[model samples]
Target: MPLGILEDNKLEHVPGTAPLNELGRLDLEIGQAIDRNILKHDSTGQIVLVPQPSDSPNDPYNWSRWKKELFTVVIAYGCGCVGAVGPLLTPAFVPLAEQFGVPLQRFTLGCNGSCIVAIAASSIFCNTLAVKIGKRPIYLATTLGLAVSCFWAAEVHSFGSLAGARTLQGFCMAPFEALIPASIADIWFVHERGFRAAIFNLGVLGGINLAGPIAGSVIQYGSYRIAMHGMGGAFVLMLLMVIFLMPESAYHRKGALNIDTGDKVIVTDKLSEASIEKSGVQEVKTSTTSIPSTEPPKSWTQELLPWSGYFDHVSFWRTLLRPFVVIASPVVMWATLLFTTCISWLVLISITLSQIFAAPPYNFSVSSVGATNVSSFVASLIGTLAAGPIIDGVVKMMSKRNRGIFEPEFRLPVMITYIVFTATGFFAWGESLYEQQPWPVPVIVCMGLINLGIQLGTSSVVTYVCDSHREQSAECFAIMNFIKNMFAFGLTFYVNDWILEQGVRNCFFVIGGITIGCALLTIPMYIWGKRARSFVFRYKLLDRVLKAP
Candidate 1:
C-alpha cells in the first residue's frame, strides 16, 4: 500500500473529528504528501530516490526579494539602535558630569564600566538566551529592556542611578548584537550572506555616526533628560516595528489543532505516493488514530535553560573555549587583535576629534563638530557597499584560477589595498596636524580614511573568523566584541590626555604609527595563516585538554 494514501485514510477515520478547514488541511496534506513521496527514498527499488527540493513556496528563502530586504532592514535597524545608543551617550559626558556632581574623568568610567559588564554578560548569556526563548523573543525583550533603561536613565537623579541604568542597558542590548548575525545566517544563503552582513554592519556604523549629530541637536535645544526621552521614544517605535513586522525565523512545529473538534490531530504518515505508483502497489486505508507529536514540546524550565543538559556537553565547552584556542593560532590571533586595535583607534579618534575640533583654532560649535560625523557616515556607506562585493569577486576570481576550489584565504588580497589607503590617510592627518593645515581638509580627510580603515578591517576580520571557525563563529565574535570594546572604552579615557601632553602632531604621529603597525601585521598573517592552522590541527593536545575530556 502507498504510505501516503494509507496515512490519509487513517486520518479520515479518526472518530468524532470533522475534516480540517481549507487552509489548515491543505497545508497539512501538502506537507504530508511532499514528505512521503518526494523526501523519502527507497534503497531496494531499481528506481533512484531523489531528495525533495527545498525550493517550495513555504521555504523562507523562496520568499520575494523585497520581503528579504525588508527583513534585513528591520534587523539592521534594530541592531543599529542598540549598538549606537551606548556609544552616543559618551558625548553627553560633560552634561552627565555636571548634573551628577562627578569629575568628568571619573564620570567617563561609567561608560567604560558599563561596557565591561556588557562584554562579560554578553559572552556568557547571549547565545544561551537565543537558544532558549528563540531569537525573535530575545530581540523583542532586549529592545523593550533597553527602552525601559533609557527611561530610567533620563529620570535618575543620582550618579549611582544613572550608572546602574547604563549597566543594565548594556546587558539588555547585548542580545541584539548576538542574535542578529544568527538570524542573518538562518534567513540568507551563503552567496547572499556577505551582502546581508554588510547591510547589517553599515546600519550599525551609520547609527553610531548619526547619533552624534542627533544628540548634538537635541542637547542644543533641551536638557540631557530630553535627549534620553527622545531616544526612548525612538526605542518604543522600534519595538512596535519589530513586534508587528518581524516574523519568527526559528523553525517551530505547531501542533495541529482541529477547528471543529478542538482536539489535536497527529499526522504520522511518512510515505509518498510516487513510490507506490511506480512499484505498482495497491492503496490501503488504515484506521484513523490519535497519537502525540513525535517530539514532545519543551517544558518551561527547558525553555528557560536551554543549556541545561548541554551544560555537561563537551562540545559546548569546546565552543566556549574555541575563540581562545584560535587565538593561539598566530594568524587568527594577530588578525583578530589587529582588528580589535583598529576598532579601538577609530573609536578613540572619533570621540577625541569631536572634542578637538569643537575646542581650539577650529572653534567649531558642539553642533558643527557633531556634524563632522557626516564624513564617517559617507565613508562607512561607501566602504560597506564596496567591501563585500569586491571580496566576493576576488574570491570568485581566485577560485577560478585554482580550478574551482575555494580557499578561505582568497579574501586577504583586498586588505592590502585597504592598508595602503589607511596608511595614507593617517600620514595625511598627522602632517595636517603638524603643518596646521586647513581645518576641514584635515578633519574630513582623516575621518574619512579612519572610517574606511575601520569598515574594511572589521569586515575582513569578522569574515575570516567565520571562515576559519565555522562551528564556533558566535563565540569568536563575542570574544572579539568583548576585547574590541574594552580596549576602545579604555582608550577613550586617555586619548585626550595623550593629545594634551604629546601635542596634536606627536599624538597623530603615534596613532598613525600604531595604525600602520596593525595594518602591516595582516601581510604576515595572510602568508602564515595556513601554517598556523596546520599546527593547531596537528596539536590535538591543546584542543582536547582545554576543552575537557
Candidate 2:
C-alpha cells in the first residue's frame, strides 16, 4: 500500500516451463521481485537504481519529485543566503577597519577565524550530528545561529567581537556545507545528483560571490553595519521558510549490500537496529524501524517536527570520530586533497578581492568590485545548470554502454573540466592582476572559469566520495571534510602573508601549479579506486573503527 506497486504473493510461471532444472532452452526471465526494483530507467532501459530505494513510501527516495526538488531549491537558496554572510563584509572591510581602528589586512583574520569554528562544526560535530538528529533540525538550529550572529556582527564594538561573530557564523555554515551532499544522497538517485549538487555548490560559493556586490551597494548607500543588519534580516526569513517548507531527508532504510565488500553500489542510510545497538544504544524501542514517518499524507502542521530524534540509537562519539578512520582510506584522501586545493584558491581570492580592486589602475568603488562578481554569479549558475544534468546524462549513457553496470569512475571523466578550467582561471586571474591588463578580462572570463571549475569539481568529488561510502556517508563526508577544512582553515591564517611575500603573479602561478598536480589524482581514482577501497576495507580494525562497534 506504499506509493509504488508492491510485489504479488504468487510467482507466475511461463507456459511450457521446465521444472527440476531440466530446462535446456533459453527462457531468460530474470524478473526477480519487481516491487523491490528502484527502476531509474534511462534511454537505454537497462533498469537500475544505484544503492536502490526501499519499498516504503516513507523512504525519502519514494517522495514525490516535487517535494524533493522544492526542498533542493530551498536548500540552495538558504545555503546561498547564509553563506553570503561570510564574505559580504569584504567590500565593507575599509569601513570595518576604520570603525575598529585596525589595519585593513587585520580583518582577514576575522574572516579566517570562522575557519576555526567551521573546522570543528563541519569537520566533526555538526556533520556528525546531522546523521543522528536529521538535517532538518540542524538546518533550523544553524539558521538561527546565523541570524543571531548577523545581528551581533552589526552591533559588535571591537575586532574581537567581530571575529567572534564571523567565527560563529562560519560554525553555523559548516553543517549546511558538509551535510547537503550526503543529504542529497537521501532522496535523489545517483544519476540525478550532479545537477542538484550544482545548485548547492552555487548557493554556498555563489553566495560568497554575490555578497561582495551586495556589500558594495549596501556600503555605498549606508554603513557596513547596515550590511550585517540586512544579512541578519535575510536569514530570519530563511529560517521561517525552512520551518514551513523543509521536511526530514534522513531515512533509515536498510542497505541492499555491504559497502566494505565493494559488491554493489555504495549507499548510506541512517543506522539500522543491529548497527544501532552495535553503535551503543542502551534501550531499544519496539519500532526500531525509523524516526516518525513523514509519509501517510500528514496535515500541513504535522509534517514539521518540534525537533528531530537525534542520537536516539546512534553513537555521537563514534560518528564524531569516524572521519579519522575514513581518512586512512586513500580514495577519501585523494578527494580531500582535490577539494582542499580547489577551496584554497577560492579563499585566496575572497580575502584579497576587495583589496585588489579597491586600490589600483581601475580605481573602482566598493560597488564596482562587487558588480565584478556578477558575471561569476551568472557564469557559475549557468555552468552548474548545464554541468549537473550533463554529467547525470553522461552517467546514464556510460552505464548503458557498460551493460547497466555503474562504476564510481563513470564520474571522473567529467573532472577533466576541473583540470582545464580551474588551472587556467587561477593563472589568468593572477597574471592579469599582476600585469594590470584590461580589468574585465580577469573579472569576467578568468573568474568565471574558476567559479565553474570549482562548482564542477565540488559536484564530482562529493558524488564520488558519497557514492563510494553511501553506507556510511556521514563518516565519509566528515573525513573528507575534516581534511578539507584542515587544509583550508590552516591556509586562511597565513595566506595573506604568502600573497604579500610571493606577489600575486607568482602566488597564483604556484597555487595553480599545485591544483593541476592534485587534480591528476582523479586519474588513479578513476582507474583503481575500487582496488584502493578494497585495500582499506581489508584492515582488521577498519570496520570496528570507522563503523564504530
Candidate 3:
C-alpha cells in the first residue's frame, strides 16, 4: 500500500465532483513508469510528467505501444481525407462548372460552401455521439458515407446536385476534423499528445495542399470525374480500415484506484471467502463496470465491434448542441481565436495565390498555379519536423524545472517561431507581390517563412487547447473546428474584396500585424493560464452546461 507524493494530489477527489482523471481533473502529476523514463535530466536526475495514467486494463492509457501507434496512423489518414475536401476540387472548378452547365462562380462555392457549413455544424452531432456511444461506429459510418458521397460527386451533372452531395460528404468527414484529436486524448497522455497532434496536423496540411495537384492532374490528363473517382477510392479503402481496425477508444473508468502506481489490482471483498459467507445468495462481482468481460478477451468480433451501448441512455440532441455551450470556456475561446488566425490566413493563401498567379505578368497556368502550393506543403513538413519531437521535450524540461508541474502555457513560447517566420514571410510576400518582383521572391518567402509560421501556429493553438481541457476535449475540439471553419469559409468568400479594398501591401501588413498580436497575446496567457483554467474549473459552469439534458 505504498503511495508516492505526486500520486496523493491526483487521486484526491473533490466532493460532488468527478475524480482527477484525464477528463475530470487538470493538473500535473508523477508519471507512470514509462512517462518518467521517457526522458531524464542530467543535472538533478528527476522524473517529470504532464499527468499520470489510470491503471484500468480497459483504459486506453494502458494499451500496448504498438496499438497506439497504429491507431494514430489510421486516424491521421482519415483526417487527411476529410481536410482534402476543403480544397480537393479547387483545381477542377472550371471543368466542373462546364460539365454541370452552370456558371463557374456557382461551382466555385458548390462543394466549398456545403463542406464548410457541414464541418462547422456536424461536429456538434458527431463528437457528442462519439463521446457517449463510442468512436468506432461513428468512424465507420461517417467514412463510408463520405466515400459514397465522393463517388456521387463524380456523377453529378448540376450545381444543386453537387452541393447536395458535398453537404453529406462534409458531415461524414466531420469526425476527422474534431473527433480525431479527441481520440488522441482518449489514447494518449498529455506529454505525448503535442507530438501526436502535430502528426495529425501534418496529415491535414497534406490533404489541403496535395489535393490541388491531384485534382489538377486528373483533370489535365483524364477528366474531372477521374479526380472524384480517386478521392472516393481512398475513402473506400479508409472505410475498410475503419471496419477492420478502428475499435472503440472511450473507456469507462468507473472507480478510483487506491494504490501508488494506480496500477495495482483492486481488492474485491465480494470475491473473498469472508464476503461470500455473508452473501451466499449471489456470485462474486466487481465494481469496475456494470458489464465485465473475460481476461484478455480475444476475438475479431469484439475488436471490430467493441462494447455494447448501442441504445445507451444518452441524448443525441443534447450532444448536438454541447459544443456551443463548451465554447464558453475561456481557454477554448482564446485557443479558437488563435486557431482562426491560421485558418483565415490559410484561406487568404488559397484564394489570393490563384488571383496572383492567374492574373499577373507571370500568368502561370492553372496546373502551375496549383503546383505552387507544393512549396507551402514542403514548408509545413519542415515545421512539422521542427515542432513534432521538440515540443514534448520542451514540455518535459519545463515541467521538470517547475518541480514536475505542467501548465498549458508551457507550450506557448514556441510561438516565437510563428512570429519570426510568419511575420517575415507575410511582409516579404506582400511587398514582393506588390512590387511585382520575380516569382521566386514570394514563393521562396512564403514557402520558407509564412508556411512555416502557419504550421507552427497551428500546432501551438491545437495542442494547447487539447491539453488544457482533456475532460471536455471532444466538445472543445468541436468548438475549435466549428468556429474556425466558419471564419475560413467567410474569409475565402470575402478576401478578394478585402484585398481589393486595402491593396496587397496594406492587406498583408494588416495580416502580419494580427499575426504578431496573436503571438504576443500568448505572453499574458502563459503567465495567467493556470489561474484562468482554475477560474473556469472553480465554478464548473462548462461541465454543468455540457452535461445538462
Task: Count clashes in each candidate, considering only residues at least 3 apart in sequence or on different chains.
Answer: 3, 4, 1
List RMSD in Å for every model shown. 13.4, 9.2, 7.4
TM-score (all chains, Cα) for each model = 0.73, 0.84, 0.83
lDDT of candidate 3?
A: 0.68
Q: Point out the higher-scoring one by TM-score: 1 or 2.
A: 2
Off by over 4 Å in 2: 1-46, 119-122, 254-300, 308-312, 540-542
What C-alpha lDDT do the candidate models reach, one value each? 0.59, 0.69, 0.68
**Candidate 2 collision pairs:** 267-470, 267-471, 268-470, 268-471
Which residue pairs show backbone clashes in model 1? Answer: 36-271, 36-272, 37-272
Per-residue lDDT of candidate 1, residues 1-549 (tens digit):
111111123232221122211211232432332222222122332111111113234334444567677778787788678756766655555665776788766676675456545754665466654543456666677789889988998899888888888888888777665556656654554335556666666777777787777776677667667877877888998888777656555542122221111112223223222223222433222211112335444443443432223122444545455445545655457665776776666666665655577666776655666677788778888888887787666655554454333334556677775577676777788788667778777768887887776676666665555444443445455566666666766775677678778877788777778777777776666665544444554565235634465
lDDT of 2 by residue, 1-549 (tens): 001112122223211111111123121221222221223333344444554455466667777888888889888889799668767877656656777888766666765656444645565788777767777888898889999998998987788888888878878877777777887887887777788878888898889889988888988888778998999999999998888878877866553322223322222245333422332422323344234434464455766884644343547787666777777777678888887777656766877776777776887887887788887788778778887677777766665554444556667778888989889999998899889999888898899988888888878887777666665666677666666666666766677677778878898898889988999878767766655555555553357755554
lDDT, model 3, position 160: 84
Model 2 residue 14 CA deviation (Å) reads 34
Task: Please provide, for model 3 over 1-549, each residue's C-alpha lDDT reduced to its tens digit, 9 standing for 90 to 100.
Answer: 001111222223211111112322123233221122322122244432223344356667667788789888887788778767667777555556676787544554666767777878787788877877887888888888988998898888777878998889878878887888888877876667778878788788877877776666667778767778888999988888787767678765433222121122121222132322224332323332123333363355767764445343447776676788778777787788888787668766765655667676778766766676777778877878877776777766665555545556667778888889998888888898889998877876665688788777778777787677766788888888888878776765666667767888988988888888877887767665655565565677576766565
lDDT of 1: 0.59
